[model samples]
Target: MSARFVQQLPHRRERVADWFARPGAVTRLTPGAAPLTPRAAAADLAAGETVFAMPVGLSWRARHDPAAFIPGRRFADEVVNAPWRALTGWRHVHELADSRGPGGAGTVVVDRIRARVPAAALHGLFAFRHTTLAGDLAAADRLAGVLGIGAGVGREPGERLPRLTIAVTGASGTVGTALVALLGTAGHEVIRLVRGAAAGPGERRWDPEAPAADLLEGVDALVHLAGAPIAGRFTEAHLAAVRDSRVGPTRRLAEAVAAAGTPVVVSASAVGYYGADRGGEILDEDAAAGPRTEALAGIVADWEDAWAPARAAGARVALLRTGLVLAGGGGLLPPLAGLTRACLGGRLGSGRQWFPWIALDDLVDLYHRAALDPALAGPVNAVAPGGVDNAAFTRTLAEVLRRPVGPPVPAAGPALLLGRRGAAELALADQPAVPARLVSMGHVFRHPGLAGALRHELLRPAPERG
Candidate 1:
């Protein structure tokens, strides 16, 4: 049987086709929720080429049919081998064409396939594919606008960004995973610094408490993301772990990088530095940190201060004071989305408290900018331009999920579940952080508004939330 799907994007056909023709197209097209990892990619979709992957612990390989290839228009891939090969014949075709409408010139993308699998089972996958493609195109267009460049202008031959050997700690965490994938796609050499045994040449063991003296040797840049999560119930031990993990490990890594002469260091931080009780004040990068009495705020202040060694050694340091990151797998979205879908969603406590949030993709891009831009040193507030309060956040999320906004959830439930301090700090913080520096530098946010971000993160398929 055959299945077909079509999607329209606000870009010319050539531009969309060129994007698909690039080397990392498959990596980009695959959902962030997929369990698949590209093992070997075809340089281009030319005839007789193949791309291999490991999907859910199984080896998957697809071969291109020379006779089915049509330059600039279409290409077809056939599943060559699989455990289900006897039961399914998977032949997929991708086609692109130009179109015009009230929205102006654009492109129409169509995916047609003949497979033995049930059509119903294929629907969600194709829908996810289309949505992801559309989102990527939108990001590219937005980035083009940010850079003041013409959209769809292909990079000239031999024109490439300078790549560096970048070492990253906490490579398994949320932001680290996203950042590593992005860096790999951009042709940088990412050496994962892990706490476990070194798996291969790509990974090196690191002990944050006592890093190897030569750990930073030959590394052009470093990103420090190793810290205990701050989401659990705020018990005395939990709070101490948070503080200890951040302060000691950060200082150790910063000192090592500095002594090794690493050129730059990008360390993870949080908006919690601004204190959990700020009212309507507009907090920027230069804003004074929260008082010492606030546990989380004090920890963040110490975390940022730990980078002093690197800065003093002439290494540029950037502290990413990130806000609420909206993504599928983790962060504050899962619980909130769960409650919203169950029709139990509502503003927390006073709903009037400002919520500072950033899109997952935007946060990843901010990390990239921090690493590559020379002017981005010091503390940078990694939040969206406009701030939304708790009420609007709840309303937007409910509207996106087609759920009703229930009554405001008083602080009692969260406080009881996550302890008073955790509830007050995370669920009820009111800092309205603005990306003033990034804005002044002409940085663009792919999902600047809550509606778009919600749709992208919540509605998108996450078969495997990796």
Candidate 2:
């Protein structure tokens, strides 16, 4: 049985066809909300070409038939060898033509599928596909003018890289969880370095203090994100734990990587290297580590220096000097949102301290970029463009949550909760850092501004204005 579905796009035939013919068309067309993920995109509609993909829990490969391909007119992908191949007759043909609606400028797209699957069951998939295609096209058109790069610039699309074996130390943490999910979906094999006994193919027991040289023998890259959480009531023991978790573990990992001859190592750092008192300085990656009196500053300096072994062993090293990450699940947003919901959300201390923030998505992308971009070596500031002050951050959060802004909280409150030094350094600290290297390298941000970031992280509707 076969069925066809068609939709009109407010674009010319050539325009729509050109987009479909681009490198990243499949990735752009894949809905973000869907569980289906593209591991490799079809570079062209050549016969026998296959697009590797994964559907949540299964691997899939969609093979193209040369006989059915008509450049700028139609192309079809038949299930060559996929989990879905067990189903009878599965082939999807994509067609595009100029609409004859007097203007002759509009494009009509048709999806003809021959499958035993019911149209009722497959309707949602096509709907999602069409909607994603239209939305991506519209977004490209809107950003074309300001970016100076018209929809002409093609996206790389999907995980074009060959499969790699990656070992991640903090595979259970916030950033780790997100990164692992992406890598797995992209068809990369991830070996999690667990402290517990290894129980599976993708698990390995790691003792940072005494790592085996052969532990990472065949691993292509290592991402070490395991560290004690920085946000807490800082105490002597807590500070020691923080320093121990970062510096010693990093040193051991670097040593192991050196012995194992791993090609690359991406270790985490923090913008706290700038210290808590660099008033009004627009710090960049070149800025020197600030006062040794500042605990975080000193720790981050050692933490970054701890990667020397990896670099000395000929492994390319990238230090991500990350900033405040705005995300829904973890990071700085949840407690702040709680405060806002309780009507206690307000500026801290003098409300003049600079706050460097990056959206969780952008941060994750930056990590991915750092791992791949060969030019990105040394310290790269992982932050968005606009550095907001504490007051602006508070106001934006309140606005996003649609809560009334409250008076500024005194320093004593945070000092008591987070310890005096921690409050002074983190809550009331002022370091205006920027992603100078990322900007120069032409990195794009998903949420560059404070308001947009808050809305995205909080999942809130756009704020109303008078």
Candidate 3:
């Protein structure tokens, strides 16, 4: 027995080939999987071409032996995972239509997948997501616009499923609130893990310091975002507060997970673990954690290590090294907003050090990506790929807000007032984490660069009265 699905697209025969022939063109979408970016299989396109792919849980190679082509009409590709299993196979079929309607413009699609799963269970698994067959077709549309092969962007239809239950600590915090919205939009049941009495509907409170395992029962995943603010002065006691806020709760949660045997666990870490090294080395996932880091870095190190119990108990662990977020509501945004409104905003310190950061929207995307991605079970930097330095960041931001950059704020002044901790974060410290793991896994970034990201996340257009 076979399943047949057809997508009707109105595009020129030449348009179909053009879309596939271009760079960054992804031919098909697989359900519960990322899009498959197909470059030409030829020299041009030759026989027996091997392409690299990191799909979902595995980073593997797919060797394509083009079996057929119809010039401007359609083409065929037979692919399989080489050196892994003879079982995995895929045939991608692309077709075009006449551009008679919609102003003589049209749609070219590369989709229609047929796979022969090696085993019965494998077949059933793929068969389940075979329902989400539109992704490949949709990527064909996006690939068209990216290379100017097509004028407009294409979007795949949305999927509606029952929400995946999610438990969040610090649901009242800015990032947590954003996470709720993001996860909620992605159809997840959000349960807030509050401290004491947030005692509302859909909330669970637990005291990590008390060491009772009530919170560990029946929850799928855990995101510990509750920690003392890294703002104000970093006194010895303040440092202890930051340490206790993260480490104590994290340790307790991990112990509970180990005892209860709950499966998925994700906790937050920081790029600060890399420490403040001004050397222009773009760190990747393989980069070892350097020893001589700062106090904040030490705290991050401890927080991540505290998850050992959960890891030992067989729960997948994710340590999110989140970057400075540029959002509207809370965080570093409020002060920047105030400055933008006053037109006195300027770059901090020397402004040459890089600031690896993500937009609030992108950060939310990271949470979703992190949760669904099972293979990602270690430290992953959640910063933008094309991160900007402080100086360029300020200028672009000012340009976006239609404001002017004033005289640069120096480190000494902030140290005198905001103290050493504030100075280190705001003025001196800089990191450019490349999000290497994400790119390798084929996660498309909506805001790749700084200016565009700020425009999308922060510099929203004023609302019209009409």
Candidate 4:
């Protein structure tokens, strides 16, 4: 099967310069090179690197192009190690077409991955599977920076910022509201999704349980963060709510977007989807779900699967498997803070289970990246790249709060004290994860490491993680 994509610039001077000039300050704006031949060097946009285009997920890599043709007018790469064997190969081609507008219009270019594989099987299996194709996508994505394209252009007097629009589901939730407030402040047009009639100026409406799907029009990007909270025990009712909260609304949103047409979809998922990574090794996106945790992990797998309609309709999708988000008001900060302050907190269980944690601010930034980055899609491990042992986590927190880290709590302590709710989570375990996909997309983490991350955001305003 084939895929076609097109992008444009207002004038010609943006893309072609001597057919290839490596995008110098003067060369990036040579002022006549319409239909610019995008530059790809030995390390820039070359063979054997991953790229995160919309159709392909965040981990999509580039295969060596036997047809690069030295100084050609395009850059292309294919998926060499796709997860599926049914698909022979997936080629990503970026071409610049001539523009009839002013300033010698040039397009950033359109990237298309045409595959020789069978569509039915690959679609049924992994629609946008591109991760294992290469080891590093960042080195390749950084190619754009070298070309002096987009942000590389710097500011030539009246430089136009890339148009950024943020679409949020559950705009009324505590976290959702925070996202809307931040996105709006960043000067982005924030579009909110509502259940009833579309009410506000920056809002749209759709109900997942409705008999008919609704319209998902004009949204360049989306963030599916709408889901009911499972605060109480995992009762049958709660389990159904948990599963449906994500899958139901997701299906409705996906179908609506299918009809109305949009570009990218970045949705939320949970680390619980990993279902207790008892295996010692870290679980990257490619890790298979273990049998013990299949039921829980299947929820995530199914949640992600529901987006197939949108994917088939040609919308890029990203599934974010977020860990324990450490925000001030939401998820876990309050209890952790209070327990430690009262000098009651200690390592839970064997203190060996891995705790994957992410700073709240970093979590927000992750959402922004998923919404804005044209390259990211598919499964992205949203936790900070580092995973600490439970003891290590407690020690780190104690050190940060200037407290002692002793008096180990037994495995049954949680069960005896707080009941099964606390015991179930503590008894189970997981391993580390790398935000490999995000880093590959050129995201510089404000909180890449832990101690510093805790010191700043938890203490003073964390310095810009730019």
For this target, which candidate reaches the highest TM-score against the unseen true structure?
Answer: 1
**lDDT by residue for model 1 over 1-466, one digit each (tens)?**
8988888887667667766776456755554444455556666766654554565567667788778778878988887885645568888898888898886677888889898978876665576567656655564444444444553334411113456788999887777776776666555678999999998877889998899998888898898888999988999999999999999999999889888999989888999999997768899888889998989999999999998889999999998898998876567888888888899998988799888999887887777667766777999999998679999999988887889998888878789878999988988888988999988887878778888777666654334456
Candidates 2 and 3 compared: the better one by lDDT is 2
Off by over 4 Å in 3: 1-162, 290-293, 462-466
Write the residue-wise lDDT of candidate 2 on 1-466 in tens digits.
7889889987667667766765445654553334455566666775655554465567667888788888888889988664578775688898988776763357889999998888766565675556546644553343333234433233322313445788989977767766665455444678899998997887899998898767897898898899999888889988999999999989999989988999878878899999998768889999878998889999999999999989998989999898998866667888889889999998998899988998765676666556655677899999999789999999988987889988789989898889999898788889899999988867777678988767655555353377
Over 317-413, each residue of candidate 3 has an lDDT whose tens digit, in order, gives 8888888877655677667756865787888888888888887656766665566557778888888888888888788778877788867887687
TM-score of 4: 0.62
Window of ten residues with lowest summed lDDT in model 2:
151-160
**Candidate 4 deviant stretches above 4 angstroms:** 1-160, 196-199, 211-214, 292-295, 416-422, 425-427, 460-466
Q: Write down the TM-score of every candidate.
A: 0.81, 0.69, 0.65, 0.62
- Candidate achieving higher lDDT, 3 or 4: 3
The residue-by-residue lDDT of candidate 4 on 254-288, one tens digit each, is 88768867788888887766666556776777776
- The candidate with the higher TM-score, 1 or 3, is 1
**Residue-level error in angstroms, candidate 2, position 354:** 0.7
Each model's Cα RMSD = 5.4, 9.5, 18.8, 20.5
Model 3 is weakest, by summed lDDT over 10 consecutive residues, at: 24-33
Assess each prediction's global lDDT (C-alpha) against the native: 0.79, 0.77, 0.63, 0.58
Clashes of 3: 6
